[model samples]
Each structure stands twice: as structure tokens, then as C-alpha cells.
Target chain A: MKLSRALGASVFAAILMTGGCDTVWHPSIPPVAGPAEFPTGQIARGAELAAIGDCSVCHTTEGSRPYASGRGVQTPFGVVYATNITPDPETGIGTWPESAFRRAMREGVDRDGRNLYPVFPYPHFTRATDRDIAALYAFLMTRPAVHADTPPNRLPFPLNQRFVLTGWDHLYLRPGAWQPDPAHDADWNRGAYLVEAVGHCGGCHTPRNVLGAETDGQALAGGEAENWYAPPLQAASPARQGWSVDSLTAYLRTGFDAGHGAAAGPMTAVTAELATVPAADVRAMAVYLTSMMPKPAPAPVVAHAGEDPVFAGACGGCHGPDAPMMRNGAPSLAMSTAVNAPTPRGTIQAILQGLPWREGQAAPYMPPFASVLTDAQIAELAAYLRSAYSDKPAWRDLPAEVARVRGAS
Target chain B: MIRLTVNGQQHEVDAEADTPLLYVLRDDLGLNGAKFGCGLGQCGACTVLVDGQPVFSCLTPVSVLAERQVRTIEGLGGNAVQRAFEDVQAAQCGYCIAGMVMRATALLEHNPHPHEDEIRAYMSGNLCRCGTHMRILEAVRQAAGQGVKP
Candidate 1:
């Protein structure tokens, strides 16, 4: 969904020139005129809040300036191209008054009264405190504006009907006001507020009813996020053997946790975003999540060696007995989500794609097996590694799985 | 010793404490319908019925199953969900079918008659990597005599 430069410019120009210029529409929250004034501290706080919201991850295109937008976010329904949020008067949100931004964030309604899709995660953002929202506004308004455009959303049929979202909003969307819970401690309440309102962990982890509203009875029983599965968050989950408050907070702060492996795919961005926030906030979130668990159980006892002949022959060199604790950041199978995943896709993916160089890191690299190993060999290695390191059952139809993944990639 | 009545027959399995039910069922009793996808309980491939409730066998320790009646896809045999699955050929790779079948059976048994939305919501936990989802939904619909979704 990467748009052509010329097309982006025009669409952006059109958005800036039309619709929202009407001040009579939103009379209640009068739009501020001239240069906006905000305290320096508010800007700094706003920067942190932006990271917590993970705004840049979804908005910015690869190799593009921050907040320039035009990145296409893929969803189950269709691709949602992010609009430019920079302060460019012609193509960005520079013309959007603070009132407009607040309305969009809190009410899921744009400046022109256009209903933004739930894909924007307004349901979560709505929970942010007014001061925090102000800080975000200050931070974004100060950014360098880029003249860019985004492609139009291409959802089929009723999904494309933006008005259909009015009903969805009626069912799921609720404008939020910060309400202090008098019972819990500040830390616990903060964690609860972030997880429920700000962080909106349930947006992905909570399974949804047919109408896409999260099933109330099952809060965090797991659901699909983008294409990746956001595993369950409650007690008796896989984390029973792996995740602790310290480890969970560490995983959230850094991309890696020794017992639970490194963050992969979409979660990497989330981890990176969390790393930018205050350490205490991350710990608070962890505390709240771990509290959901029944009790702490010792980590699973998985044997590391003498599991598979194929693994011993091919992978034992670097991931072997003598392998360094952190070799090019490749995680151990005993703690790797790849091997422990229910579907062979993650394991199959790692074997086929190897490890790519991260954005800023100069780390160890592994060669791809697309040409190096046969489908049968890859299958055998995957099965062996998963069985050896994990107490879980082995995935069936390994050869076919390898072939399918191989062909697709 | 853990006594489990799986697929109607009773078996006494000897294993260390906290060993997953999957290990005992497959390695000991030789009931292999539940495939191991993610041993972490992230995937529903290792699902079986523990007292008519679908549970992940890979994450469930045998110690938790002392008094529970365990039912696997093999136990269901020719039940409506299985027959409907067979009729529609709902499986692609046939790896996740057992788990899906077991979960579907549990849903039908729980509801007896479920709307399409109800079935979808209940079965959302189960995933098919082969993308046999639509056909699986159709199969469940057929199994419930709900007729194939137009």
C-alpha cells in the first residue's frame, strides 16, 4: 500500500484544503488560533506518551521521515493507509486544531466529523489523561512537517462503508475520562489503567465476538493481532513456566528475555516503544499482568542436548554446547517462542529466513536455509528442535509445512 | 500413577510430576489425535476435552487430570462433527483437524443449537494454519444441521 509520491501529495493537499476548515461544526471545543503555546515539560512528557501509544510505528513509512505517514497498515479486513500527522499546513495535521486532535483521539471522530476506523486504536487512546493528551499534541505539533500522501483504504463492500463504523462505534467506542480507582495502589491502578485504557493490550490479546467487539467473558484469552497471534495474558498461560514480573518487565523494556526469548515481528516495535518510556511504568504494567497469574511456577525443565541428530549436525556449532550466551542475539530453543509456537510457522520461518540485521544493531547473522537445506531436512530439524527444547507435542505434516512455507516465501 | 479414562478405556500412566497430558497421552497410551503444535498452549492443535471442556493438552499437567474425563478426537469416532468434517473434507493438511473437531464437538454439545455467530465466537480459539477455516465453519454449520452458509 505504499503510495506514489505524486498521488500522496495531491490527496494530502485535498485533505488540508477541504472539509475541516468549517469552524461552525465543532463549536463546543473552540479551535485555537495562531501559534499554539505549550510548556517545555509538556512537550517532553508528550514525547514519552507518543512512544507509549506506539504512534510512530503505525504512522511512519519505512525510510520515511517520522510522522510523515503514508504507511499502509494491513488488517484482516483491508489495508489502512496512515495519513500524515506532521504539522504541514497543506498535507499534514498542522491545520488540525487541538480540539480536532482531541476529538479524533477521544471520540474516534476526525475534525471533519469523519469516523476513524477502530484500526487507529482510539478506543485505547481515549483513556489518556487530558494533560498527557496535551503533551502528545505539543510533541507532534513541534515535529518537522513532511509533504506526503497516503493511499486510500481498500476495504471490500460494507467494511469500506465508513458509515458502517458508526454502528461499530456505538457498540464498542466510548469517549473516556480519567477516573481514579480509590481502592488499588497507585502502581496497580496505573498498570490497570494503562493495560485497559492506554496500552490497550486487550485490543489484540482479547478474543472478539462475531461483531468484532471483544468477548467480555474472555478478557485476554488470546486473539490475532495483525497476522501474528497475541497469546493469552491471564493466569495458567504459557508464561506460567517462563514469565515473572521481573522477566516480563524486562521483556517489555528490552526486546529480549532469557527465559521467554526475544520479541519478534510486530511485538519488536512495541517493545522498542516501551523501552522509551519510564522504567517504573513498564514495571507497573508487568506487575498488573503478573497479578493475573495464579502463582509462580518454576520454569520448564527442557533438555538442551542430544535431542536431534539433524540439529546436532547443522545447528550445534553456534547454538551448540559451546555457543556464547548471546551469539548474534540468536535465542536458545529452550526459551525461544519460535520452537514453542503451536504452529510450525514461526519455527519454519526462523529456519528458512535465518536472522536479519536489526535497524541499529550490528549483530550476529545466520544464513538463510532456502537454498542451503532441503524441505525434508528443514522439517526434520524443526521437529527435532521443538521436541528437544520444548515438552510440547511435535507438529505434524512437517514436510508439507516446509514445502508450503518455502513456496510462499 | 494417573488414572485417565480416554476414549472410553481406562489407563494408568506412570510419569513424573507436572508432565504435560500430551506426553502421557501420546508417548504412553498411544492416542495421537491431538498433534503438538505449540507446547506453550498458544495453539489449539493439542486440544482435548477434559470433562467436556476443551483444554490444551500440551500445557495441562497430568496432575490436573486425576479426576477429569479426557476425550480426544479418536474418542469421538463417528460423531456428527467428525462425520460432517469427513463429508466436507474440512481438513487440508489434516494436522489441526483433531483439535478443531474436538473443540467443535464441545461447542455443539454445549449449545446443541448455535447461531453462526455463536459457533464462530466459540471456535475462534482454534486455528487452522492450512486456511481451511471457511470449510471448517461450513462443516460445523452442516454438523449442526444449520445448512451450509450461503
Candidate 2:
């Protein structure tokens, strides 16, 4: 969810806007952190699991030898360097036994039994089954080992104390494999396992409580990731048009759906990686997700007296009647997902920076209007789209909202 | 197995209960007029008349249509709206026309001669990415003027 929002080079805007937060998770190279322990017996599945776990992303700093930890992860409290997970006898986890690696992953402790920082995402890793962890271990250990020293961390006083994560973990971590519901079909169960546990998609999607535990009852309801608002995944989301299994599957697999447009932000990276996961697995995720979508409410139509010349002069040149096609044809804004989205953020971001190429695919293009149109003008145009095409209520105080969003990102 | 009545013909077909009626119509029954533009309901491309009202067939599950009458462009027949659409050459690519025809038929069935404003608001849900809005409006007006019930 937030992945789509963090799309484009504009994520730097998120960093500029935040005042020290968990924004480290966004706009990073490498994929989500890759796994450490592997099921060496199932090396093939282990490699797949590592990609899904994003083990390589967090653990390996960009341009650095793979898994040679030294990549600085910026957290609200301080910076944490990822640990080396390669097979180097001296530097990496080469000498550690599977049991020690398992303890470190499941218990958030290191070889010498030191507490590891929560930034390692151990809370989510605890859900990985023993076998899968072993595969990941196998995958990591077999890598052409790189000899690089693990960088020292620079954390604020108490945050520097690694044991602080213990209390934090006690409050937030629930270590166990996600058990399945007997009632759901096999595909649904598969999807639940992948989404809630293996993929740990909810780690970034679900909102965290003060103790940093994902809040209950708000699952997939959206969160602020790396400064982007991952829109709610629940069926009741403001995405009034709704998501079908096919659309969701396509979006998850390819990152582009005519209704939703291209994936923006870090989601581009995810969908790129997701392309490698089994197609059946992605389809199952869609099946489970479409079941969760809510029916849309009856939205009244907005009657207008005359055509807003603003649209005619600008959007109309391409999107208006007789307008030439632009950007695989400017998606007819009338039925467009961005326009109909419950929150104005997607629409706002699209206008700020036109959709960019994703996964080697070039979509229709519209030059960014950030420098061209004033914030007030954008708000009016957006409001006009809601009233003109869709039956949803007009966005409130759209001018200030646009300025606030634009200024922040 | 699900039973459905399409174009006044009753038939039983094998499908998952939640499979979209559009798929049932196109893939099973071989009704090909409706196109799948956006499987989501936002776009009315896969629209068909369900009990005299235009419903997005892509989003309407076969289970929900078990007892309802379904009408695709193939079932809509050659009505005044279809005639006007042909007379004015309203369609360019024709991918979206099947849904457009279905929706216009429903609009005229509910109101034989709706005002231009009503036509614009009602048909807004039907997207014509080919820039055929003016011709579409003209066709609707021509249909309304003919005083033919859809």
C-alpha cells in the first residue's frame, strides 16, 4: 500500500518532510531484508524464500558484496547496520550452527547471545517455519562469501543498549507460525500464510501501536510507510470502484492496472520481485484479497452547470473530448482509480509526478504539473474530476490539502 | 453448477459461485459483445442489463445473477439507440460500445425521453476513451426523439 505511494524519485520529498521517524523502510535499494538461516536441504525454495523475505535488501548495502553487512539502516532512534549473513568463516555466519542461527532469528539474539535491534524485523521472521529458515540458511551460507566487517551502530544512549529491544519485543513480538483457518479454501489458506507470515506484507501495511505492535482490528487498513500513505487494503477502502481478483492479481504481479495506473514508490520494487514468486501464489493472494473487498456505497452525482474551462485548456487537450491520446492515453479520468480513490493522495501524487516506467514497462505519460499548476489549481481540477465523472463526494478544502501534500513530499 | 436466464434462455453451467457473470457469459455462453476493460466496477465496459438495470457484469458474480434476467448487447436487439448509434457512426474502436449500448438501453427503458443533462450524468459511468462523447450524446438524443421504448 505505502509501496505504491513511495513510487518515483519524489520519495526524497518524504525524507525531507519527516522529522526523524521509521522512514528508513522506504526508498531503499536492495529489496526488503533477505532471510539469514536457510533450509539448506531445500536450497531452491530457500532462494525463493530469501527473495520474498527481501533478505538481500536490508542485509546487503547497495554496491557492497552480497550479505556483507555495513548498510546503515536509519531509524527514528538511531542507525543500525545490517549483520553479515554470508558464509565467510570469520566475518559472516559461516561458523554458526543452524540452532544458533535459529535462536538469533526466532529469539532476536546474536551468536554471543546479545540482543539484536528490532530493526532487523525479527518480529516478522519469527513466523517463518523452521524448514523455510533452514532453506534461507542454506541459500545464505552457499553464497560466494564476502569478507567484510560488520559496521558498528551509532544509536542514542538507551537505544544503543541492544537489550532495549527485549522489552520492546515483549510488547510487540508474537513468535509463531501463522496457523490457518480451517474454513477457508486451500488457496485462501495459502494466501493468508504468504501475506500474513511468509511475505510479512502486513509488517509495512498494518499500523503499529505505541508499543510498536501492529494494532488489532486495523489489519491492512493502511499505514504511513516511509512517508507514503499505504492505502487501506480492506474492502471498505475509499477505492469506491472496488477490486476484482483479476485486477488485484494483475496489480500484485505486474504493478499496472488500467483502473489503478502504474505502481509508484517502493511498490515498484516489490512488484518487480513479486514477478519471480510463483504465479499461482500471486493469484492465491488475489483470491484471498478479493474476498476481503467491501461493497461500495451509493454516492450521489454532482450536477454542474457548465464545463470548467480549466479542464478544457489543460486536461481537455488530452483527456477532454476530441483530445489526442496521451500516456497509453490519459486513463479516462472519469473511471480512473486515482480519481475515484477514497483518499486524494494517489491523485495528488500522480499530478505531482506523472507515472514513471516500472518493471521495464513504459506507460502513458503526462508531464508533472508541480511547476506548471498552482496548488489551488490542482485542488480545483481534482475536485472537478470527482464531481464530473464519479458520484463520490467532493474532496474538502482540497487547495490546502494539495499544498500540504505537495510541500511535505 | 449455476442456472442463469440470459436473453430469455435458461441454461445451467459449471462455474465457481463467485465467478463474474461477464466471464460466464463470454467464456461459457459465448456472448462476446461485452469487453473486459477494467475488471473492477469503475469502468462500465463489461456492462449488461440485469433485470432492466445496467450492472457492471464484471463485478456481478454469477451467484448473484442466479435468479435474475441478464441481457448483453447480443440480447439487447436492434433498438432505436442501436439504430441512432449506427446512424451517427458513434463508435470508433467499438470496444466500449457494447457497454454503452447496454447502458443507453437501460436509460431509455427507465425514462423514454430523459433530458440531455440526465443523459450526460447517467452515461458518465460509460467511458469512451475514443473521444466519442459528442456522438454518443447525439445518438441518445436521436433515440429519445424517435419515441421508441427500449
Candidate 3:
């Protein structure tokens, strides 16, 4: 009787442990059926749509087999490996039902009722239509199964626990398909959906808060990732290359922007896959991106007399009564390209680094006063320069400008 | 272990047979010009001359390079491509120049002078994100005696 009781206890303990293991080990959610069955054509369309989504970028290893996962994407908290989407029974999405896939893609939930971390970008995928989502499921279902089991994510202790994401989702996630604005043209609406939804271009291009959520109001207003700046997609963008629609299309397709900057870092991935997309879609994206321009405010001119004590005391020694003509290679404030550039970033850089004296050039060059000047003083100087020459408003905050400059440098 | 000849010089290195020739060049021989862009052989930033043909170094494993004479951007035609690069100001950040030059050099060696469509098709595999394609195209044309008339 004692031996039988002990055996029963051992069996119960094994079952409990196995169940717990299953809960943690299985990354996928239980499969759920779609609202309606997809046709064969829809599945094929989904394969193409998957390409539009650029699904291979995040999921595939850099040099290994395509879509077999094991790519480690770094986050603020930790690194997460993209799971296999191939139809491997043990390792990939072979067993995931269509509903589970939809839920994971749209709601950021996993099989087994656990909330998936937002790093998968389901927040943006939530905008995908039901038809499109079903198609994507069909396409994924058809891909050859590769039995590569990716290692578990290495997140910080509390963050490693999946429950925390429930709160995060509550605050940020809005689960639903994209609803077209009835007022807009089909092309415009299509462009908006493509840019905002499947493309998820903003995920990397937009500035984010400390929590890694995008600052919604400043959408596509530039961000920093992997030590490179993803420049703003607004009209105020100082395009190194001119921003014509045709040029933009070519740049998007080829990853070169003619006279503008090349895509680097994460953008390389974007261009490689994105460039291969339809030309019309590329043009639409350009149109939508170019349309977003922050309205220009009227310039405020602050008149400062030559005799103003503040200006006379601080700047007279170098600039003189009439801002001295840039001569002998000392960039005259009057003719300085650094000062005249459309954006003040170049001028700020010059001020911070100081004008270096060319060989056999003038000696009284602009000195590096960055160490000596307080943030306020620098702001005043910049304000004085802009007012005295160009009629542009001073950047609101000097410290932030300084930080951006320092970070870029 | 694989035996390879680079710029007509023979060498032997031990690595995973599947290791990309770009890694072999960068990690083994310390040639850094061929950058690692998208490592799936998508972007041609890792272009190098494989027996006088432009090939993506990232996808060409060292094992496949056994007994093959390889040429990098560094060893092309007395750096004629580099001169052309300077003449047209065909570099911005210069990260893509090496690959661009390698590809262009291969084009010139094969065709001497290629049409715009031909150039575009041939160079499509290589990406220049800086938007210097016009200047680069102009430079290639100039090298071919097509001049800057177009």
C-alpha cells in the first residue's frame, strides 16, 4: 500500500512538471480558424502580400536558410530571436491554426493564452485586413518546413516574464484591421495603408520614448538606431538629393538617392526588400511621404542695434560693427555658407568645432568656445546670428540641439 | 582548408567551408574595403572580381573559391576604377564605392562601353543608397570615352 501511494505521488508530480514545461516551452498560441475560408488565389495573393510585408527581413538569418528564424533582434531590454515561421511540426508554425496566427499577428497574443511581447511588431500588423491576414496564413502554411529550433530570448528578469506585456498592450495596442477613410481617393488610401500597416516603416524611422513606443504626434520625424540617424520623412527634410517623386522612386528602388544619402544600417534591409516591390506602390509611398510637411510658421525677427551692450560686449571683438566680410578664408558672417545653409545644423557644427585656419590664411579665426559657453550663451549667439542675417526662429531648446549634434558627431 | 589566389597571389586559409569569401577577405586577410552590408547576398556591397566577373563576396563561400583567382576592389586594373571614382566624385560616405568600383570595373572589362540600360541592368544588384547613381553612371560613361555630353 505504501509503495503504491509513493508511485502515485511521483506520477502526479511528473504530470505537473510536464504541464509547466509545455506552458513555457511552446512559443506559439493555439490555432484558431479565420472568419471565412480562403481560396487558392487568396493564398497566392497572400504570398505576394507577405513579400510586401517584408516578412523575411526580421525572421530569416542573415546568411542561413531563409525564414528559418534565429536572427537576434536587439531591444532596449534584451535580445529576442525571431521564431521559425516554416511549417516544421516541432519548431515552426505547422500546428498553429489560422485564428491563433491572426490573434498573434493582430492582437500580439500567443498560443497557450500568453501575451506576446510587442517586439514582434503586431501593433503595426494589427492594421492588416482579415483577408490579407488569412492570405498570409495560407502562404506561411505552404512554405517548406525547416526544423530549426531557435533559442529562448534572453531578457532581463522581470521583463523576461511575459505577463508585463499585458499592461504594455493595454496602454499602447489597439487591435483592429485598418478602416479606410471614405473621404480619400483609393490611391491615397492605399498608400496610407501600405505605409502605416504592412510596411511598418515607422517602427525604425520614427522617434520613440524611453519605453520604446513611438511618439505618435511626431510620426516619422526621425529617430536614432544602431548609431545612425533615420532622417525625418517630412517636407522639412534636408534631402541631400533633391526630393522629386521620380528621384524618390529610383532611390527607393535602388537604395541610392542620387544626390542624397544612402540607406545604411536597418534601412539597408528595408531597401533590399522594399525596392523589389511594385513601382506604383513605391511611387505612392513617395507621394504620401512628401505630402507630410509641418506647416511653416512666420519668422520672428528680434532687432538688435549695433550698439546693443549685450551684442557689443560678447560679439564685437570678432564680428565688428558691420559683420566683417568672410575674408582670407575666415568665413565672414556676411558671406559664410556655414551661416547661410538652410538648416542650422552645419552652422552649429562649425560653432562647436571652430573654424580651422587654412595654410597662409587669416589668424583671427572663430575660436572653439563650446567648453566655455553655457547652453544659454550658445543659444543667444545662434539667435543673434540668425536674426542679424537669416530671418529664422531660434531652435527652442539648445541642450537638445547640443545633444543631437554630439550624438551625430 | 581552402586554397585561393587573390589578385594573382596564392593563399591558404582554414575556416568553415560555408564561410563567405567576404569574411575570409576581411577576417583572414584583413581586406576591409568589401563591406558587410545585407549578408544574404542581396546588396552587392560585398562585390569582388571572381575570375574577372563581379560576384557577391558574401554569398561566395571560401570553399567554392578553391584554386580560383579572386580580385578585390583593391587590385582592379591599376586602380583605374578608383581614378574614375575620383574624377566623377563618385563617392559620398564611400562605403559603397569599393563595391561599386568592383562592379563597374567588371563591366568595363567585359563591355568597354555599356549603354545606360545595360549599365542599370548590370549594376542593379549593387545598391548605392546615397543617390550618387547619376554621377557614378556619368563616371562609368566617361571611362568608356562616352564623355559627359549625356
Candidate 4:
């Protein structure tokens, strides 16, 4: 009877220990269906869908095997190395189930139930539909295995702790796929999906607060990145790079507006990867960007100088009473685009750098006297020009302004 | 060892043959015009003329250039195209100018007067983040003359 009682006690102890164990061993991830069964056509479609996500930019390291993932992405909080997404069983997503992949892409949760930081662009990607997401998964699984291992991130104390991300997501994230609006056209809807889901343009161009949360109120407006301004994408963009649909589309495909501006900084990477994408998608992006332009405001007119002493003495030589003498092809302050720009930054820049003359044109030229001019003098000249020919305000700070233009040059 | 002819001069160098021609040009030959905007072959800042074709020097391995003639921005002709660039003031910050000129030179050599669409298609790889593209297009068009239509 004592032996029987001891046996019962042992059985009960084993059951209790097993039930309360913290280290539950999960089964190995099951293999996804082979690519052959999915049809090669789907894979090609997947490739186009993957391009929308720009998967290669962050996932692959320069000069390394593609998709191996050792690229370091630096955020304000810390640096995170992208993980190997290739199918290597030892060091990559080789064993990730399709469901887990869908959950991670749509909900920003890893297979281990860890909340992924928004730096991975899951905020925008959350809008991706399951069909497209599944296609992407199928595409990724078929890629060859790359046996590279990126080092773990080195985020600061509380932020470094992955558990804290759970609360962060709860406060900031809204988990769901994109919902098309009944009011918008098919083209606009497609554009929105491409922009908000696949393109993830806001991940960089949009302004963010100290916590790296995007300020939605200022959507597509200008922001700063790595000390350079990501000029607003809205219709009111001061740079005037996307004035037309053609210009916008051409800029997206070629990485330059051909007449207005070109891509720089992080945008350089975007354009490079974008070059490989289909022309149709690029055109769609251009249509989307162009449609976002607000109504054009009438060009602000500069007030008459009315015999201002500085212009009378120093400027009259070229900008005379009538028919402003074109020096160095110096654009007539009366009708020049540089004089009429919304912001005086470019205008001030032109003055400081001195306008370069057209080589074969008969226009007069002005040498850049930036070296000789004091900060106040440059500011005064800028103020004088803006007040006389344009309605723009003088730059708030002159030295700082000159310094910025000088730095860019 | 790789045998490459740069700007008509032949040199033999011993190194990892897979090293990008951009590095070989910048580090080995001290040709600094090919800026390193992105190490991947995406950005055309490292574009160079390889056998009269514009190739991304960053993606083209040094070994791939064995006995190949390479032309950089420094070697591009000082013709109407260069004069047009000066006329339109097409460069800002000038970081991408070398690459831009090289690409344009290649375009002009193949099609002396390319239309707007052709210009856009051929020069899409080069990136100018400064937004000076309008001036660039105008300069190219002006160089090729205004009569050419896309």
C-alpha cells in the first residue's frame, strides 16, 4: 500500500512539473510547398510585387550575396542589422511557415512572438493584403539559401529590450490591411496601395518625432534626414521639382527631374533599386505623386524697389531702369524664376555662388563675391532682391542661411 | 593580376580580381571622379565607358576589364556637349557631374542627337539628388540641337 501511494505521488509530481514548465520546446517549422507547384507565372508576379516592397535594399548588404542580410540600418535610437532572410536553415528564414511569414509582414510580430520595431517599415507594410503578402512569401522561400549571420542589434537599455516593443506597438500601431475607399478611382487606389503599401515612401520622407513616430498631420510634407532636407512631396513643395505628371514620372524613373532637381542621400539608394523595377510601376508612382499636388498659388510678385539706394548704386549697372542688362546671363531680377522661387534659399544661393554665364550667350555675367561680402551684406542683397522682385520673406537668419548654402556647395 | 587600359594607358595590377573597377580607378589610378554614392551597381555615380558603352563601374569587376579600354569623365571630349553643360549650369554640388557627363558622352556617341524620351531612358541610372535635372535635360537637348524629337 505504501509503494502504491509513492507511485501516485511521483505521477502527480511529474504532471505538475510538465504543466508549469517555462521552457516549452516548439516543433521545427514545416517546409513550405515547393515552388514548382505554385506555377512559374506566380513567381514572376511575386517578383514585381517584391520590387514594390524594395526588399533588396534593406535585406542585402553591398558587395555581399543578395538577400544574405548583414546591412546595418541606423536609426536615432540605435543600429539594427537586417537578418538573413534567405532560406538557410541555420541562420535564415528557411524554416519560417507561411502563416508565420504572413503574421510578421502584416502584424509586425516575429515567429517567436517578439514585436518588431517599426524601423523595418512594417507600419506602411501593414497595409499589404494577404494575397500579395503570400506571393511575397512564396517568392522569398524559393530564393537560394545564404548561410550568413548578422550580429544582434545593440539598442540602448529599455529600448534594446524586445518586450518593451509590445507596449510601443499597442500605443502607436494600428494592425490591418489596406481598405480601398469607394470614392477614389481605380488608378488612385492602385497608386495609394503602391505608395502606402509597397513603396513605403513615408518611411523616410515623412517627419518623425523623437520617438520615431511619424507625424501624420504633416503627411508628405518636408522633413530632415541626416542633415539634408527631404523637400515636401505635396503640391506646395518649395523646390517645384514635380510641377507636372511627366516631370514627376521622369524623375521617379531617372532619379532626376531633368530640369529641377535630383535624388540625394538615402534617396540615392531608393532610385538605384527602383531602376530595376518595371516602367509601369514607376509611372504609377509618378501619377500618384503628381495627383498629390495642391492647387498652384499665383506667383508672388516682388514690390518695386522705388529707387532703393543699394539698387540705385550697386545694382542699377545691370538691373537698370528698364530692360535689366543681362550680365553673365544674369537673369533679369524682374522675371527670373530664381527671383520668384517660393523660398529665398535657392535665390540666396544663386547670389552667393554668383550666376554662371551661358558660355555662348551674349548675356552679362556676375562673379560670385561671396568671399568679399559679409554675412549681413549677403542678407541685405537677398532681402533687397526678394522685396523688390518677389513677395517672399527674407530668410530669418542670414549667417546660418549662407552657411547652409555654402555647406551644400 | 588584371590588365586594363585606362584613358589609353595600360597598367597591370595584382589584387582580388572581383574588386569593383570604381575602387581600382579611385584607389589604384587616383581617378576620383567616379563618386561612391551607393556601392551596389544601382547608382550610376560610378558609371564609366567600357568599350564605348556606359557600364556601372561599381558592378563591373576589375577582372572583367582585362584588355578593355576604359574612359572616364576626365577623358570625355571637350566638345559642344561640355560647352552646353557650362551654358545651362547643369551641375550643382558637382558630385554627380562626372558621372552625368560620362553618361551623356556615351549617349551622344551612340546617338548624336537623342530625343527627350531616349535621353531619359539612357541616362536613368545616374542620380542627381540636387534636383538639377531640368537644367541637365535642357543642356543635353541644347547640345544635340532643338530639332530632335522623341
Candidate number of the best lDDT: 1
Model 2 lDDT at residue A291: 78
Docking verdict class for candidate 1: incorrect
Candidate 1, residue A108: lDDT: 77
Better of 1 and 4 by DockQ: 4
Q: In terms of TM-score, which candidate is stronger, 1 or 4?
A: 1
**Candidate 4 C-alpha lDDT tens digits along A89-149:** 6787776787777767776776666667778888787888877877887788778888998
Worst 10 residues of 1 chain A by lDDT: A19-28
Residues A1-409, model 2: lDDT tens digits: 2332222123234334542335232221221233354444587777777767767667876568877878787654456889888888778877767776777778777666677776777777787789877877777777878888888898655456554455555556687776888999999988777777667676666777643457877888776444445666776555545677787788887776756555665466567667777788888887776778775334334354356644554455456545555454334566465566666776777766554433235433343445335677678778887788667777777887798778766
Which stretches of candidate 4 lie above 4 Å from their native place?
Answer: A1-37, A295-409, B1-150
lDDT of 2 at A383: 84
lDDT of 1 by residue, B1-150 (tens): 777678778888888545677888899989889999965444589888877778777755565555558888787658888889999999999999999998898888878779887888678767899999999999999898742210
Q: lDDT of candidate 3?
A: 0.66
Q: lDDT for each of the candidates? A: 0.73, 0.70, 0.66, 0.66
DockQ of all candidate complexes = 0.01, 0.01, 0.02, 0.02
Backbone atom clashes (below 3 Å) for every candidate: 5, 29, 16, 22
TM-score of 2: 0.57
| TM-score, second chain, candidate 3 | 0.92
